[model samples]
Target chain A: MFKRSVFVAAYLALSAGAAHAEFSGGVIKIGVLTDLSGTYSDISGQGSVIATQMAVEDFGAAKKGMKVEIISADHQNKGDVASSIARQWYDRDGVDAIVDLVTSSTALAVNQVAKEKNKVALVSGAASSDLTGKDCTPNTIHWAYDTWMLANGTGSAIVKTGGKTWYFITADYAFGHALERDTTAAVEKAGGKVLGSVRHPFPSSDFSSFLLQAQASKAQIIGLANAGADTTNAIKQGAEFGITRGGQNFAGLLVFITDVHALGLNTAQGLIVTTSFYWDLNDQTRAWSKRFFEKHKRMPTMVQAGVYSSVLHYLKAVEKLKADQDGAKVIAQMKAMPTDDPLFGKGRVRQDGRKIHPAYLVEVKKPAESKAPWDYYKIRTTIPADQAFRPEKEGGCPLVK
Target chain B: MNAIFGIPTQALFGQLLIGLINGSFYALLSLGLAVIFGLLNIINFAHGALYMMGAFGAYFLLTKFGIGYWWALLISPLAVGLIGVAIERLMLARLYKLDPLYGLLLTFGLALIIQGLFHNEYGSSGMSYPVPQALQGAKDVGFMFLPIYRGWVIAVSLVVCFGVWFLIEKTKLGSYLRAATENPGLVQAFGVNVPRMITLTYGFGVALAALAGVMAAPIYQVNPLMGADLIIVVFAVVVIGGMGSIMGSIVTGFGLGVIEGLTKVFYPQASNTAIFIIMVIVLMFRPAGLFGQR
Candidate 1:
């Protein structure tokens, strides 16, 4: 009996030791809160998770004596669901930072929870300017695109080119409203007039009526202030209804290359839009995009690229501080230094926690212009970082003062 | 004379035309839902997914298989219907004896699984399905330059909606369906294969949704989550129309769509909430629905 008990005890100790080795010795846990299985699932879902994994792997999967662990959960595109998950991750799961929140509403909700928990939030997907504006949090960083960049990239550029008379098909939501308001300001500043506008429900499937009104208005420019599937539907229906052939230009205020690829160059040709990143921008972008496509099976979108850069920068911050699990120290170190990543080019974090990066104005490639799959955009111009975002004093970030 | 709100007549009429176009989709989708619900007693939570799948079917047929929109219009729905048949026979038939809620739950689960698989393959960005070469440009009507595809959608949806109504209301097969709904055991005792009919009926209803989806592909991007957001609004439309009458579902769907369009012109802020507001009013006044017998 004694011999049998000794053998069992020895086996139990060996198993426990292996388990300890797996997670022990200073672990840094990152919670990737994303819309993995909901309305915005296709936009930033599993791709964001993949980007986080790539960042961890690039960092040698460990730094100093610490092993980097990435834990992911689907926010399901609901604010309350995101908040609950974030609360759980902070209070019980030993998570030091959260990244890749996709929707503006969910991002804001998570930002508040991250603030309360004193954890770092590297927001890569949500594009609301308010993340760095009225709703800004000290613990949160708006890492990718925002309303200001989109407004300056598409709205101002078109207005300056003499497509001055404007109408808008605005999505009726906070994010939509912000895009419209910011883009409208940019247009009016460029000596354009707002002739009229229409607000469609978010995720509206039919846009024939809106297009007809746009056609009738005879506006020189028709701006689409929507994103995701709504923008896709509006642009497609706009082509079907022949709004462009009637001498009106269609401007996508918050478009991505994927939307252009979906609309195809035939319908999307000559449609100008602004974005922070495009896969085919240059040799550098193409190199990073090639690896991402190999892993994800699709070209990396601006959101995906942002996810890669945010994760890389956060991991770098962890290494600099040498404290694997210190959220505040790591965040302070991140803001104290400039960010250098292949995806973002060269960027810096401002006082308001806004990541300052050059925004690009890209036109949809003509079908004949695209030589291969995923080659959907041609860069029109580059908006300098200083002009891409609102000035610091005007940003309305309470932490700025 | 100027309008009460001082809105111009031409603009009002233009906006009204827009409303009518939106109403067309509402009517078509709701009619399909009502037909399926009457016999199956199950709210197809996957109806939107099926619709989205149909759009993708048309897109794939055109882009990869070199098929055109017209062929897609016919084959895509049939293809999706076959998928529906398989699902019904393999999975849904087993849940019939349980609470009707099980069918809803099962279909919802199926929707999630299908949508998840598509998202995994095609990320969230919308992909465009091009208009066929023949239907490339617009018809200049002076008042509006109507794209040929839009005209086709409005016209085809009308024909399909009425054709469906005629099938259920005037045909012997529809009589059997109605009878089965009233009492399946009695219909079975009369030497009718009611269970098979039930399965086919569900498949047919699902096929209608898929047809709408295929028709929509050229007009909208074919995205994985396309059906999810549209489905809730459709459910609200169905609820307001009352699942009792097919024609009611069709009319309410179209009427609410037009109202929503008009709201976009007059009160831009309330445009998104207009349909839901109407639903609330309908619930308050006629809880059974505008056309419901109750």
Candidate 2:
């Protein structure tokens, strides 16, 4: 009787292994919805799309007897547009998962749509911590860095290291509000004081008035609670307006490699920033980024890198589950299994859907210090994975239990 | 530290200066739009694209040919103006007899195509152009620490705005150009070469937009979408000041900029909306505009 039972169990296991990955219509479709031509485009647009493809190709989907199809759309950094595109992708196009919603508005919008449709949305581009906080959902995975991580990384570092009094030129949006709040908390915790902050319009090209406000506040540090074009423009205009000369330094709360490249080393030099990934961090990163650069001609930003990592992790979970039918189930599996990828190395998706990874605090290299084009950061310190993200209990996420 | 509406006086003063500096751009851009609409009876939606091209022209000249900012200030506008001439000759001239909406659609489509092409090449993060070496520093002017370049921009825009105003309102050729718009057939019968004159006027108006763009290159990062973001605001400025009134555009452009600046100081979040609110108020009150005649 024991021998018969053992043979039966082995046969059941073999059949189950053969039946892994019941892709919809014989394939898993991943939609990369991002800002293709707007303020946040360069960092997360075509580069992100290419990264998603590379992840699929590197995962060897064809060899695994699984077909993966990738499609992309420009959310244009608008919430309504993102929601509509996400609804169509999930309801009509059979996209099992969506990735790389760049702006916070788009990410939050798509997050809700994915939940309603019972599909997966992996966020690598958005920076708002609300995704893992009050808004955390079972059907979504918040990959890479969020506002809390950025504040905990760059904010604490700057405050503890002599940037005591801060005035913020905040973008007038969800991401900006969240960042300002988190950074304020981080600053106060680090024994620093926030003098004041002014909200500016989103994606504004002129920062003269806002910078003047910060200058007049007489703060030791001018914290930029914005990102992409808004941040870059502020930093450039700050120099011209003598905010730097007046001895008020700018702390770029979410500076990307593309933003740094656009600002050039001359202007961006010495600006402190926090990021989840840097291409030249190690041999593994260098090798992967080299392959990426060979394809995209620019180094991958953290958002782009996060997109690749999340897609790979999502794919693995889908394979393990033997189907992509249930979004929550797939996400739970993704959480149950530890994530290992070439971009972020070893990490895990927490119950609140936050991806845990080490963060880096780097200073923009002086023009003289840079050796080549795109050689931007001089990595100052590494924030270990455990200390990088918000604590689960403190995040107000109902899913934490 | 004395306050105005809870904002520090020093800050208020600084904001006022910043507003005027920004107003310089508004005046220049709206002035060009006013001139174009006045002469051509067409809403040239491509003004912003032409502005973008002007910045790119300066960027390319500097990056590729080692040309400095001074030469680019002149060359970019002229070069872009020539492109404007081609546009007028080939496309805009054909739309002269149609509804103004047709001209608007054509130019609007042109703007999209132009912006899309540049965006495909540059990807919209934007490229930085350094302020000229001579104007690289800032001067502490008590109320504000004004960047020398900003001061130069304000001064030059004032001179340019009034210079164009004088040429169009005072000179013989200016009257002929104005007359062509009033009575094109009569102007042509008088051997004024009205067609060529209209084309050159459009070119000149485009060049004025380009000039504003070249000046803006250093203050704002040169991006494909830079002009798109600001063009709508300039249009509002033109509307509020009374479209097609050169002096009206110049005054309201500067005035709205100052009001918007104050909004930045007292209520920083509504700075972008301040102008629109005023536009609504003016529209409800005056219908034609603050200065536009019905």
Candidate 3:
């Protein structure tokens, strides 16, 4: 009778498995929304794509009873386009999570849709602190850098050096304005004075006039409160007009390793900037970066590293839950668990959805200092994870309170 | 009265000089765009890419070929112009009979392909071309320090702008080109090979952009996206200067650049939007542009 009962149970389990496979069993989709071909493309596009694939591969390309399918699209730096795509992915494509959004405008737009739909949005690129602050959403996770990170990295470090007087070349946008404002606070707190500032239009091609004004101000530090192409142009022109050699230091308040690489170390060298990760910082970073570089043919920037870590943690959450799909439950698992990934060592997700991790202050290496083409930065200092991000009490995240 | 509303005279003059330097690039790039548009009727969207290529060509020539800036300045543009000619003959020529919009679309696509290919090879990090041994230092005027490169750029752009203007306005070939633009059929009846002229005109226009790029190499890092961003502003400048007149594009380009500079000095917040503001006002007042013919 016991043998008969065991045979009946095995037959019933097989029938249940067949039914489960027939109804819903294939690939678990993760949609990657990124600025693939616009102003911020160089900073996060191709590298983020590779990072997401790496995460999928690391997960054995399957979760639960389903294979993982990574699908991505270029947001083209448009917020509405990103939102529509996110909505489509959720409604049609069965995308469980959206990862590697770079621009804050696009990230916020996607975040809203994700919250309304209850799909997970992992942001590894966009750097507005508001992602975890006033604009924080329950379903969204800000996995990478933010305005606070930039301020603390560039502002605190430079301020300590008594390079206190500042003249800002700000991009006329939210990101640029926030970076300028935050860094200004850090500068003042460190006893620096604001000399003057100029706001350049987003995607300004020529920065001669702005650099000239900055040079004339004779401020000790010229803060470039911009990112990507704008920052590259400002630094290039600054070097050209001898603004750096004119007794003023060029401070890249928000810059990426790719920007430095594009600017080359000669123009970028001696310009102090802050970042969370430099591919050459340590053995672990080197090892991880080497694999990334070999795969992508480019060094991994912090944003790329963030993608890897965010996706890895997301998968771990999925594995722990033993469910291939379910955004709410998976997100809850993610927040409840401590995060560990090859890119970000060990970190934790805060209640506010801010992933706490260490940030770095790196200087651009001179051309001679670089042994390889992609070797661009040297670690100047490491800001502890606690000190790197804005404190929970000050973060203004409703969830945190 | 001497204080001029809390702004120093020296500060104001310094800002003006800065404006002139920016204006120089504006004039050069707009002049090149106008030259190409005059004959081709297609906005060479790849103009900025060609400019970026010129800079990279100079950088590579210097680093790899042991060429100096002066030689690269002359050679890089020619090299890039030749590439432009090849592109025109092989690809752009096929699109000439279609709507002018097709030319713009084709060139825009070409720009992407060119920029993408370069970015793939070089990455986004820029390569620096050093200021030549001769142009290494700066000179102090009464108000501010003037780097030789800045002075050189301003002076050279002025000469080139006027030179191109003179060529289009006064030369026999330019007159023939203008005549062809007016009525290519009539010009062909006069036994001129209008198509060849069109090809050469495109090449010359591309060469102007490449020349500007070569001049810019020592000033800016050679990068793929350098031209992509600048070309948009140049478009705005072209609209602000009316596309009909060569001299008009030159004047409006320089003038807007100066205004953009002054905006940085006074309000600072309005600097970025100042050019667009002027563009709007020009559209409101003249509709065509400041120098544009109705």
Candidate 4:
């Protein structure tokens, strides 16, 4: 009688599995909203799109009896444009999730619309900590590094290394302010002092005046709390002004592999930066980045790498659920599941929607030390996953129960 | 040992030098605008775009043709100027007799197209143009470490600004250009071939802007949208200078740059808006401008 009951239970489970498969009829569509042809494009543009496609293919959704599609649009780093695209994708195009928003403002804008429309926002390119802080939502997951991660990684390491005095040349915005605030706390906690800081106009082409102020501060380290074209221009012009050779160190608080490529090893050498992923970090990263480079003609930046990891994990959750549910439910499932990917390794999403991963403190390799193309960084230290970001309890995220 | 407003003299001098360098760009760009407005009666809104093109022209010449800074300095302006002549002859001449707003709108549209094309090709991340081997280092002038190239820019700008002033104020071409500005009909009646001269004048003014662009190439990033917003600032400079007197534009460019630099030292936050504030104040006092005629 017990054996008969067991056989009946097994038959019922098989019937339910088939029913779940039938319910998931349509294709899983994802929209990649990013700066495709702007300053951040080299870091998270077509490369990001390609990475998402690779993730979709590698996941083999078709083999698992599901179809997935990826679409993309250029946000142009404008918040309004990003929000509009998100609305259209969710309301009209049946997009289940959006991924890889480059600028922080644009990412936040999309985050709100994603919340309203009940779609997932897997942010990989934007670095603002506010996504998981005051602005955190149940429908969004900040997968990559944030301003907090960068500040903790680079600022603490530099202060520990005896570069005790610092000056900041910050981009004038909420992004810059958050970075400066985070780095200052890290520096002060490590027994360092912030001598001064100057905020330059946003998207500023010339940083000479600000660099001059940083030079005059005579701080042991000049921290550049900016990114994209602003960061590149500051570094290049800083080299021209001989700011690095004048006995003061330059710290790039948030830099990407693309930036180091643009600045080249000669100008970028000896600069300290923090990142969550590097293509040559390990065997798995190398394998994945090599494949990506084949398609994009460049190695994957951390943001691009994060896009792959987040999409792969999202697909895994979808397969586990076996249906395209509302974004909040899908995200809850995502939070419940452990994130394991080749790019970022085994990770977890906090209750606050912050994806936990190890960030690295890296120094750009000098021209002579580089052995191959894209061999740009020498890892100084690894920031553990738990300490890499702000604690969930402190973020004031309403979703963190 | 010296201090101004509690900031060290060294810091003050450093910012002053930077202000002067920026002033040079303002002067050159505004000078071109004023000259073009003087003859063409239309604000050349594409001046900034042409300036950006000038920088890109230098960049392409150096990267593609193996040409160095010296050759780029000569070729970029001439190349951009010729392009400018074509624009004036082909498109701008059509709106000459219409309201000035039409010319403004037409040029503004052209600026967008040019900027869009360049942005499409280059992206917004600026490509660096290296300082020439001749002027690559800084000179320790006891007050601050003055970049040699920055000093060179100021010197060259001063010479160029004065040279243009002389050509317009004292040369034989000056009389025809001024006479054309006052009475193009009369000048044409006198057999001056005013239409061809107008085209060449636009070209000449654009060439001046291109010259500034070439000079700015090594200092700033050679990017597409570099001139889009910068043109707004130069427009502000032009308005404050009244655009009526060529000398007024040059003097106001340098003087306001100095004042803006001082504001940076005393209160860094007001640096970007200070110029616009000054523009408003000047306009309130003199509606035409500091040097503008009714």
* lDDT of each residue in A279-304, candidate 4, tens digit only: 89889999998899898788888999
lDDT: worst 10-residue window of model 4 chain A: A1-10
2 against 4, candidate with superior lDDT: 2
Pairs that clash in candidate 1: A42-B123, A42-B124, A43-B124, A262-B127, A262-B128
**Can you tell me which runs of candidate 1 are displaced by over 4 Å?**
A1-25, A324-326, B140-142
TM-score of each predicted structure versus truth: 0.90, 0.96, 0.90, 0.90
Scored by lDDT, the top model is 2
Single out the weakest 10-residue window by summed lDDT for candidate 3 chain A.
Answer: A1-10
lDDT tens digits, residue span B99-198, model 4: 9999999999999889878876665666778889999999988777888998999999999899989999999999899998889889999999999999
Clashing pairs in 2: none
How do these models rank on TM-score, best leading?
A: 2, 1, 4, 3
lDDT per residue for candidate 1 within A1-401, as digits (tens), equals 00000000000122222223323234667777887665465557777777777776665643333467677887766678888888988888777788988877788898899888788888988888998999888788898899888987888899888999999898877777888889888899888988888888666767777777777778999899888777778877776776766788889888766676666777778888888888877788888788877877877778878888888888788766666444566677888989998777888988788898998898888889889987777888988998899898897889888
lDDT of 3 at A80: 81
Question: Best DockQ goes to which candidate?
Answer: 2
* lDDT scores of the candidates, listed in order: 0.79, 0.90, 0.80, 0.86
Q: Please report, as a residue range, the 10-residue window in candidate 3 chain B with the lowest summed lDDT.
A: B1-10
- Model 2 misplaced stretches (Cα beyond 4 Å): A1-20
| Model 3 pairs whose backbones collide | A261-B125, A262-B124, A262-B125, A262-B126, A263-B125, A263-B126
Ranking of predictions according to DockQ: 2, 1, 3, 4
DockQ value of candidate 3: 0.42
DockQ of each candidate relative to the true complex? 0.58, 0.77, 0.42, 0.37
Q: Give candidate 1's error at residue B14 in angstroms.
A: 3.0
